[model samples]
Target: TQGDSGIQRKGIILGKELARSLGAYTGDLLAMMSPSVRMTPLGIIPKIKMVEVVGIFESKMYEYDSNLAFISLSSAQSLFGMKNRVSGIEIKVDDIDAAGHIAVVIQKKLGAPYFARGWMQMNKNLFSALKLEKITMFIILILIILVAAFNIISTLFMVVMDKAKDIAILKSMGATRASIMKIFSMQGLIIGVCGTALGCLAGFTIVPNLNKIVGFIEQLFDIEAFPSDVYYLDELPSQIQYFDSFLIIVFSILICFLASLYPAWRASRLDPVEGLRYE
Candidate 1:
């Protein structure tokens, strides 16, 4: 997080871990070596320069904090024997998902040696794994929804069995079969709607605080959920997609509606005289 002084000629800003390992701090001088070797009068030796430590930064990411450094473009160019040019440039865009398309457009517009590489291309494997994880999670959610739908079906069947005589009486009183079906179907829809609403409410309440929840679990169990060396992130991150939520609601209600049909049809087809006699 350190920054105020500029990285000037032979001045470098180092990662905190790097600084700690070297016991170097601001205003300290250190020798920086270039990988390329130059033919010296004595022998072939690597180019080296005395660089001043301008600042030390902490990023909380192990790879960056341990291995990264910052220097002025001119100093870097001179040190690397690039004279006046840089090998690459980094550009940030608003929509990361459209990065590949944007990169293609950039390449088309600025032809020749100019090229563009997006974050997606740079981290393709990571995103692919994340996409697979998302698919698996959705599959599990669908299975859970199906189990809930089965519960609704079993509950409605029990209700139908308990209310057989009432249903028979209603039939005798000239209630239409469709009317009976609608009543039971509406009941199932209500159950589905309530359950979905509660689930969504809980999700909304929990998601924003998920990191805190994970932290608590980690502390209680003495475990590391996001070890710095193992995971790229320091904590869990969550984003709620409204479209996905809407789709889940629709799917759940449709399943419940379908589950209600068989029980309602059975109730509709019961013989009034037999139902009454059995009761």
Candidate 2:
């Protein structure tokens, strides 16, 4: 790690094999310079120095691949001439979900000198836009379920028309108007449960291997892999919360129940004399 004042080169950190791969090893001199550019009367001067490699470290991320150099905090601070001052500090919370509350607690604990931010707050704009897009996509996808519910409505309405005489006979036999409603409601519930279950199953089956599926499609279609740069994530991310799944199932059932209303009411209002006479 290089800083403004000078550099700290030799630090025994990484082991032998890694150092050899990086073309660096213990006792090898490494040079580092401060990031600051000073405009003197003569010209812009950059502070620079060299250090002997004592150790090396690696982080799995591509951003840190082959580029990160480790140095002592004291060396960094002195080199930058930032006496007792740091550009920023990183904090990690035990539970990521509680980051917002933790950040607030930290701010309060530390009082006025420092400001704290959570990961979500730091990425608020990006996450907010993603949330909006996801909601819109959900609404659009739900139309598929709604359309399926309409199919239930159409099928039951036909059954009502075909069984009008039976329904009338039931009504005359002391099966109250509400009982007639229950019959059709049960039919609609069956269809809704079947369709929602199938849809949920299909979603789960596809989501787990979505990346592999996309890779195959890209190869077959002769297109590039999905754009990782734009998306920031390497693969599609799907977080399946059981609660969310339950909400979807409940919502689909409601759509189906509501769809049954008009047709069921029509069946309940029919007169036994008129229905049987027509038959």
Candidate 3:
């Protein structure tokens, strides 16, 4: 409707990017060829048909936008010389996670010569690569948090030494060793908890807007960070997994707890006499 007044019986709708690449627009004629061949006077030749461009569409994925096209079912069948037969039909399911199962069911029902493939199967490699990237990023994050935990450990040890005289005075005042240990352990754990909370706050606030942030930087610098053609994407998209975030936070907190242990134990073991004598 946006292009030609109407889609004629033999008209086609080209993808936006595809039309741009072909320098074609509304009401333009395009020659479509099919692998099906016919015996000609000279030799066998591929079948070809000239069809009017009726409209254009976009799917966000550069791979689809740059290569996909749409035509009438009858027109496609005629082009392939498949008379009354179709290559395939696309079915959309409400739940994407059940796609593979539905595909199997369809395949079983269709029986011989007919098979079904889900979107996941069609794009397996891409998803696998994405999973690997997630894993690598997670590992890197853990390493960074581990380094911070070591810093916390060092800081707590320093606190224990700095407060040695105070511990001696507390012991003389009839304070229990467990209470002293609890004080140092809590100091380290509290530091870790606060840092984790702040990091989560920043990550949640920023990660969702990464696309806009990157776009601004690119515009400011006159640079292209993610080239559309190269990445097969019109723009970058990000999704946050709450479960993964929860796991990371829990692990970081555990690391902090572990880092607090040695220092707390050493503080509890301090000899009040030695501490007072040194003072």
Candidate achieving the largest TM-score: 3
Q: For candidate 3, write residues 1-279 as lDDT tens digits.
A: 257645579899887888999999888899999999999899999999999999988787789888888888889989989899987889999999999999999999999898899999999999999999988998899899889989988998898888899998999899898998898888888988999999999999988998999999999999999998999886788888899889989999889988998899999989899889967
Regions of candidate 1 where Cα sits further than 4 Å from its true position: 3-5, 16-30, 58-63, 94-98
Candidate 1: tens digits of C-alpha lDDT, residues 1-279: 665467877789998877888999888999999998899799999999899888888887767887999988988888899997889988888988898999999999999888888888887898899999999999999999999989998999999889989999999999999999888988888998899889999999999999999999999999998886678557776888999989998998898888888888887887889879966
Superior candidate under lDDT, 1 versus 3: 3
Per-residue lDDT over 187-245 for candidate 2, one digit per residue giving the tens place of the 0 to 100 score: 88887888888988998898888878988998999986746435544456666788988
Query: lDDT winner among the candidates?
Result: 3
Report backbone clashes per prediction. 1, 13, 0
lDDT of each: 0.87, 0.75, 0.89
Q: Worst lDDT window (10 residues) for model 3?
A: 1-10
Query: What ordering of candidates by lDDT runs from best to worst?
Result: 3, 1, 2
